[model samples]
Target chain A: MFDPEAIERIRAKQRAWEARELREFLARQPESRADCRTGSGLPVERVYTPADIAATSFDEIGLPGRYPFTRGPYPTMYRGRLWTMRQIAGYGTGSDTNQRFRYLIEQGQTGLSVDFDMPTLMGYDSDDPRSLGEVGREGVAVDTLDDVEALFDGIDLEHISVSMTINPTAWILLAMYVALAQARGNDLGRLSGTCQTDILKEYIAQKEWIFPIRPSLRLVRDMIVYCADHLARYNPINISGYHISEAGATSVQEVAFTMANAIAYVEEVTRAGVDVDRFAPRLAFYFVAQADFFEEVAKFRAARRIWAKLMKERFAAARPESMRLRFHCQTAALTLTKAQPMNNIVRTALQALSAVLGGAQSLHTNGLDEAYAIPSELAMKLALRTQQIIADETRVPNVVDPLGGSYYVEALTNRVEAEVGEILKKVDALGGTVKAIEEGFFQREIADSAFEFARRKASGAEPVIGVNKFVEPPEPNAVPVHKVDPEVEARQIGHLRAVRAKRDGTRVAALLDRLAREAADPGVNLMPVTIELVKARASLGEIVGRLRQVWGRYVETPVF
Target chain B: MPPIRVLIAKVGLDGHDRGAKVVARGLRDAGMDVVYTGLHRTPEEVVAAAVQEDVDVLGISLLSGAHMTLIPRVLELLRAADAGDMLLVIGGVIPDEDVPALLALGAADVVLQDTPPDAIARRVRELVAARQPR
Candidate 1:
């Protein structure tokens, strides 16, 4: 990046300036902190000179679309085609969510990301007593093929791309999607979307896991094989770093831990007789765009480099696309404040910009009222408008990796990559992600980081403007939040009963029995068989229940 | 006597337990007894634990909008279980419109996400002050 002699001379001059000018200025006005660091607590130098990125050269940080693609993935990047504007949305019953999905598409949203309710997410049916109140509060409730069909009711499967944010029952929903597409006469090869089948992260962060580690990985493997053979365009698993960050991981930990899970998935798929290159290109990531602007940009760049290195060096991936780490980014929901609810609008816009500058393949800008309830229609429209404003008005996307050669960005990128590499080595030494998870490694780490952050906020050291620093009286009359109707749960249960009564109960039972038998045999790909069961009106709970007989439930180890 | 026994339990299927855990840790650090039932506990199980533990206060955190159903059930269970005297403090992404209903359902306090940890401790202390003269 810089000549050796010039870097040496610059370092000497910087030291001289710090000794004289910095000391004199500091004597009059002391620095805010004794030292400055990035959001991840990595120490930052006062001034990043050529000396910092002295070893870097053009080949290492080459143009976009090249190997070790630290800058960007595509050649022209946003100039060629802007990143997909995919807003995550779902609530109430499937039919209710179907309306919301249709609205988003009409609003010019480029992609669709589905958020399932707790009952559906945990693989439970609407009628289960445990799922009594939680049928459709958080997201849409999908219990059978009928729900999935209703959810995607009027949407064109060929045009829109969907990302399902589910893990424990991801494979079941994927089967439902395939069945729905087949029933619609849509080409299975052309169904573009991603199923978040990454179960390891569920145990580490979100705590929504159903089966134990080994068996869950087995399900993930089976889905990968099925997707590779059938749906070439759809991603079987979105190895998520988003939950890790939301659960209190540092940016570097988010990258390292997520990539660790990706490696575990790759190892599983390969060990299941599939080649790494065959499935690696379809592997995608989901990350959080936190409040730190430059740090978020550098984190994405470093993640790409680390992923490329991992695929090429370790797995010996054959194709160039196999080494590319294509990912979807969501604005950090943790950064949104419940206080001054309108301020969240600004926070979301800033985070959305960070995601765009970071070159995310897809983006989901959270709604302003998300901290209170499901977003109101007005709020969702405003969020979509924020993305549109950035895409249309902003000229930042005209060039690729616009900040590729900055001293500060390059140094931070290297620092993040090196720290994430260290964490990966630690994960590797602990045997793998599975063993580390069993030992509560990731959970403990996230807890410690979370506690540290909470401590900082409590002490008023890290001042959040609307929360800790600026106090405000409650606004008695505030934003109108979208609420799930009380009738939604009852209606969903009634629909479930109707489906059960209308379908051949005896036939459904026999298909479930066959499903249970096939589930016991690890060699079977449950997608096709599950599709048959769903076609016969066998509900999600029934199939998952049969497998639960074999796989058993997962109880998380307490971290606090 | 002993510190104020508080059971911080997560009700229903919401997996975002970070707030509950943070409040539990803060309460524990404030010299109170805090027992977390981990994630996905039903209302019946929560009330049963409240009765069995004989906790002075039961703090149930819910973010998945299941509170309208779960909170009323827990209150009913507490009354049926003869544990109606227990104070219930609810927290997490609860809508402003739902606050009055939650309070009418016998919640001692409806704490929003923006409330500080120390404020939570102080509120709990004030709530239990009258009954602590044993």
Candidate 2:
């Protein structure tokens, strides 16, 4: 974005300075390492100047809220209204998690994000044998409409935006949510929330899949179509890179794989006769704000620019809202340490700062105690306070895209965008995301990256302050670990049984039969019938089981 | 001598297999025959596979907080199958307090999160060596 003559002058001056002053300093003191690299293994230069970003054009790094939104998504980002502070909370029964939700809201959390337990996430009811000790261990267990109602017991659904972190059973959860709203007579058009129905990421990174690839994509298409028609303000699918990053992908792979999956979704929906602008506006994204501060910021900026270009040129989405890439970011949980637990607080604060500086629309700062288990109440409070401190005290948000024009950041952003383009080209050559997934391409890439990172840390090349460097004696019970009650499984199962015993079994059966019949037909959207099945008290397992009978389950060949 | 056979299994619905896969590859690189059971395998399925594969070491990797209930069940089934001699090594997000109980329940060792893969491979070698006839 600099004038060529100005850049040439700057380059000549930089070379002269390096030759004279830099040579003497380096000869005497020398650099710390032979090479410095970001977490993605991108080389870091000793300094950056106008010459670094000389090749970039002004239009590519346009103003906020404009096309090629490399700066930020909005004209007045956090200055207008701060990013939503959403701490994902779940463990134990729905009511148990609801209490935590209310506690977070009382503690100044702006938005709600639900974390479903394995059973709920995998489409198993609390009573299913597969749900055994896992009913509510990792997250809240939702079996039916009653559990969902209890999960949101005292919360106002209209005002607060909700994000459900579910994949395989996301459509069922959406149905339960819509059923809850419909039963409460809340306006469907006013429901603002996001269902992380991005099933492509499941095969790529998360490893949480129910139906096979094509069928899963079909379910995602059904959700997008249904939500675009009904839930006006709700995001039907949150195309996510968060789990991909958490599963050991580099920041570049995270964005590239997620975008490839997004492209696949857009293609799937459009091929099914849905308009691009119709559903694309409601499409949201989720990414991780990793520990590399400037790299994370540059990654977010590059991600937004890549998405904007994709929407404007590739998909032909006309609406500005369709082109604008809004994302929610969570601080890297893998960075937290089980060794010096308290150090995680500082780590989280800095990571959250990077996310805010990157202009995330919503953010989740991980609890310091997350390395052990679901975080304790005190840890969650500390995590929330970290966000509050950044928003109120840091003054980082006063200017939109504070690091927008930094030569280093701009150059890094361009580099990240280029790397993502290369990866996407590979995904395309493998015949798109599903084909690549079937070929185990994404899985192998992530596994290799994860191994490389582990090797680096193990060899002391990559230093984790509390893990490999400056180690200390294990502090037993340094932080209170949030323990899900052992009796949660039995109680949750009893609740599921009560609901089943009270509801009309025949009607539930008929509704499930209709669901299976409709699921057998590729032309039908399953959301409407699924909602009816949930309203009739068909458990999450029941609905998913019927669909499984129709569509079949997905099993992956081991990659590693 | 034959290479030490290692079966790294994810014995629950938890999908956090990054650690498991890395450890599996690390052990494989360390010259062990490692087989990963992918994801979503139940405790019964895990035990059955351990027996069927005739693995020398059954490494159970659990991050879902279901270890307290699931690990013991795997141990119990191994005993019932008369394969109690197989080395049982636990890994992933186990708390410090739970380590003692797990060890007391006949677990050869409990490797907490971020223990270097090379260290894990060394420990497995020691355990296998100890199990051999003197």
Candidate 3:
């Protein structure tokens, strides 16, 4: 055993040698001063040593799967299993999307992610007068459980994980999923998936909300409690920053606003008398990995550290699982360019690499044609292959947190945390995220940021490769755009009409009436009634319209 | 002249509204009245809003690739409401091959995101001008 003083002396000498080498390297290229900054614009330094990490202790920044899991939530991480490969799927009707789902699974996709059409997301039926012409056009339209049953027809509920990107009426969709699982004879406890039931972000970024803030929050809490009690494997709320970042918030605002919303959810559910440890474990997050490689990496790392710390300190979660912030990521669709559409493949691949390196549990890569339209099958295959290449070929996941402890990355991580901390404080001061959203704080911030990014692109400060710089005029004849089935709407409407004509209309009406009464009951959880309504073949518009009758639709009161 | 009132709505389940919001804001900035009927609006609601607001134009945005289906329904609603005089415009991630068909189906014009807001506004003004017989 060596003496402590001797060991200390050896370490100091080693540090001095590294400094000397770095100084010599920098001196050789004096013009290339290693100035550093985070993706969110916070300044960073070229080097960090004991002086920088002096305050961080073993207790504060512990080992993987330990308290305050700054490094990672899992012990083995990707060494044991690769991140879940979930490609966002939905197009045409439920049956069409169902086939796509089965195809994706056969192609080695580990999980399923559903993209709903505008009418479905807005809680309208396929045949709703307003929903006409739009059914299954943008995404799969599911007006009733019949559609949901068709969407997951061949898929075994117990085996595959599903993620539904629906909000506002998330409870309705979740009910559909549960009913489908029940019909399949799968134990609800065994079935797993995620509902992006984040209402605050809906107000902040997506704007697909139906109820006013308080009631919307009540519904969110209801799902959290219900899922925690019933379907323990399911992720109740996927607190999302993807839309926020895509909608134009900077990386810092994306993380800050997302965390603020997450905090709001935590506070609300806790206020509703649910124990934090019971449900926090299943609470997942969805974030965007943008073009900024290292910054995006740092944001992910910082998010983990901050969330773990919050869980331990703020919520006092006893379970390590509760503290572990499991997240799913998708490459930023906003960063993809319609000009040089091919470049998007590279853009998506790089963003996805950042997500894996940053330790995401699940990931989706955007198709190259996303900026132009819904991705053609060819483009989608390429997107899936990009993730496969990164996983199998790159060997990036060979080491856990491969970019961990890099001077630039660590410094960037610290800077991002500092900036986001300031934002969180502001959100907290505004009486939390709900009040801030109601007051239009988050929306105003995103709009301003979006405007800035656009202005920057126009002024040539931020270069958009094909859009601004390196412009190449597209050839007169490029790839033919993918054609959607023009008859899709007519066909879907016909099917819906037949379903309505054949189903006992009186039974459907009675079920809907029961739903209306249950929704009106403040104490009554609407999920059960929603399940009954869906089982009775009640359409989405009727279900949401009923709730809308009880809880009037939200009118945005602009906070000036 | 009173502000050029425009009603914007997403007819189907395409929840992508970034373009819709940007265009709404741009039109508002361009001294036009903009009312965004948030996602999943029915054609009936849109037509009623157009009739009630007496808007000069209706701009519909869809990213759900459902514009082909959704646009015709909105047009039919307009015709039913006898508000066909109000110009109907559409935009979103539409395929170039589908543009002519959408126009033929009664859309005054199909604007893509790549097209500048000013160009779209100018087109709106032109349609309004043409409707007035010079």
Q: Give the best candidate by TM-score.
A: 2
Q: What does the lDDT read for residue B50 in candidate 1? A: 90
Docking class of 3: acceptable
Badly placed stretches (over 4 Å) of model 2 are: B132-134
In terms of lDDT, model 1 sits at 0.89
lDDT (Cα atoms) of all candidates against the true structure: 0.89, 0.92, 0.81
lDDT of 2 at A115: 94
Each model's backbone clash number: 0, 0, 16
Question: For model 1, what is the alpha-carbon lDDT of residue A344?
Answer: 87
Q: Residue A193 in candidate 2 has what lDDT?
A: 90
Task: List model 1 lDDT by residue over B1-134, tens digit each.
Answer: 68999999999888887788788888998999989898988888999999999999999999888888889999999999998889999998888888999999899989988676788899999989866442
Better of 1 and 3 by DockQ: 1
Per-model TM values vs. the true structure: 0.98, 0.99, 0.87
DockQ, cand. 1: 0.68
Candidate 2 lDDT, A1-560, residue by residue in tens: 67789888998999999999999999999888989999999998999998888888899888999988888888888879999999999988989999999999999999999999999999888878888889898899999899999999988899999999999899999999999999898999999999999999999899898999998999999999999999999999999999999999999999999999999999999999999999999999999999999999999999999999999989999999999999999999999989989999999999999999899999999999988988889999999999999999989989999898898999999999999999999989999888999999999999999999999999999999988999998887898888778889889989988998999999998998888888888999999998888889899998888888888899899888
- TM-score between candidate 3 and the true structure: 0.87
- Order of quality (DockQ): 2, 1, 3
In model 3, which runs have C-alpha deviations exceeding 4 angstroms?
A: A1-38, A44-55, A58-60, A502-507, A558-560, B1-15, B20-61, B69-91, B100-111, B114-134
DockQ comparisons of all candidates to the true complex: 0.68, 0.88, 0.34
